[model samples]
Target: MSYFPAFLKLDNKKILIVGGGYIAYEKLEHLLDFSSNISIIALELSDNMKRVIEEKSLNFEKRGYQKGDIKDFAIVIVAVDDIPLQARIFAESKEYNCLCNSVDSVDYCDFIFPSYIKKGDLTIAVSTSGASPAVAKHLRKYLQELIPSSIGEFLQEMKELRKTLPKGKERMKMLDKKAHDYINTWSSK
Candidate 1:
């Protein structure tokens, strides 16, 4: 089945991650790019995980995840290797109406993380409906190379134009022309 694509505003929202090993650490790294309001629950943390927590100054509990640990969080990521625990947390997350992702277990996941490229305010997400993550990653990398480095600057210029130009059909036409011209020029580089 195909999943809907949506961008969430995560500012001030609570996010819970259950685990602190290598898999959890990987998820944490990706999450850090989008939000800082994350709390991790784990029995023990890896060195890299500890460093990220300390650097970000995130909320953490140094113990095993409890039955009700997913409370009040907007999103919950279960990265533990134990399948039963992943399933249990995913099931419990539903009680709190939280979106849950059980890392590699698609059966218990409410959503899956997509491979993405972030350039300044621009974000492009690539997904294959949980079919092949490797392909998604490769596509993201290809897109990253294909996109021009000047795109961020171009976006900033567009933002300025949007603010300065008055609301009218003329403004829309001008903006459309500018975007088309910029893309045509950048694609040649």
Candidate 2:
């Protein structure tokens, strides 16, 4: 099935990760880009994983995941090689009304991570509805090269200008036009 594309605001929300191996570390790296409010449960952590958790001062429990560990988390990511555990966590997460993502297992995922580019306040995401992650990664890399380094500064300028302007349809239109023009000029270069 085709998945919906969305960018969640996870600033203050809690995220639970049930693994501490390579895949878990990769997911943690991605999550760090957005939110630092993350908790990891694992029987054993890789050396790099332990180092990262210590460096970031992230919450971690060095134990196997329990049955009712899905409480209070806004999102849960299962990255273990154990398919049964992944399915179990995904099911448990559903009962708690939490979104779950089982990496490499689309059937057990409520959502999939999109390859993305983040520059200041700018975020661009690419996905193939879980069909081709490689394509998405390539497209993201292409965009990373295509997007000008000045785009972040430009966005900051736009943000400041927006605050100075009155809130109205005219202001919205002006901002829209300004952004479009800026992008058009950038793309032509």
Candidate 3:
């Protein structure tokens, strides 16, 4: 089955990563784009992982994952290569009311990470339901190039206008036209 696409606001959510290898590092990099409330528990951390942990001042445990390691997290990512370990963690995550994502293992994943492009407030996600991440990645890159770099600033202007304008259909129509015109102008250049 296909996965639903939605955007999550990670304002106060806590995330956990149960690995310290390169794959775990990749997950960490993606999570860091949206949140910093993350902790890791793994037997050994890669050098790059250790550096990022130190730089971000994130909590971590060098020991192997314990039974209750995921109890306080809202999302848990099992980046370890062991399928059994991922399965165990996925089951445990259910008891803790947390979402689990096991890297490269769709059977153990509550949700798959879609390749995305983020430009300030704009984020576009591309997914193939775990079929072809390479295609999704390349599509994301192509979409990114098509977007103007000043989109964030333009959105900020629209935000201010919305806040100042009174609520009505006129306001909605005006904003819609403004956005449509902006996109058309950018594409034309």
Candidate 4:
């Protein structure tokens, strides 16, 4: 089955992560790129995880996940190695109307994390549904290398122009041409 790729506005969204191991840490890193309203629960945290949590001062608990831990969350990420635990949390997520992502378990996922590149205001995502994340990651890396370093500045200039320009077909045409011309210059590099 194919999954749809969508960009969710995570502002004010509360996220719950149900582990503190390596996989959980990876998910945490990715989520950090967009939102900081995350809380983690684990029976025990790895030393590295502990350091990151302390540095960021994120809300966390050193205990087994409780039955109701997912109640107030907008999204739940089950990164524990235990399949049963992941399944249980995924089931619980439905009852709470929260999106759930069970690592390595496609059947229990409402969403899968895509390999992505975030440069300033630009975010490009590459996904292979549930098939192969490694391929997606490699593709994202290749795409990232091709994007020019001046892209962020160019995008910012476009933003200012959009705000200052009057609303009309002419303004739109000019902006479109400008964007096209900017992209055309990339091939020369």
Candidate 1 lDDT over residue span 111-155, tens digit each: 889999988788999999999999999999999998898888989
The TM-score, computed over Cα atoms with residue i paired to residue i, of candidate 4 is 0.97
For model 1 the local lDDT of residue 129 reads 93
lDDT of 2 by residue, 62-150 (tens): 89999988888999999998999988998888899999999999989999989999998999989999889999999999889988888
| Candidate 1 TM-score, true structure as reference | 0.96
lDDT of 4 by residue, 30-139 (tens): 99999989999999888878988998899999999889999999999999889999999999999999999999999899999999999889999999996889999999
Order of candidate numbers by TM-score, starting with the best: 4, 3, 1, 2
**Poorest stretch of ten by lDDT in candidate 4:** 43-52
Give the poorly placed runs of model 3, Cα more than 4 Å off.
Answer: none
Candidate 2, superposed: residue stretches over 4 Å from native: none
The C-alpha local distance difference test score for the whole of candidate 2 amounts to: 0.92
Model 1 — which ten-residue stretch has the worst lDDT? 180-189
Between candidates 2 and 3, the one scoring higher on TM-score is 3
Q: Count steric clashes of candidate 3.
A: 0
Can you give the TM-score per candidate against the true fold? 0.96, 0.94, 0.97, 0.97
Model 1 root-mean-square deviation: 1.1
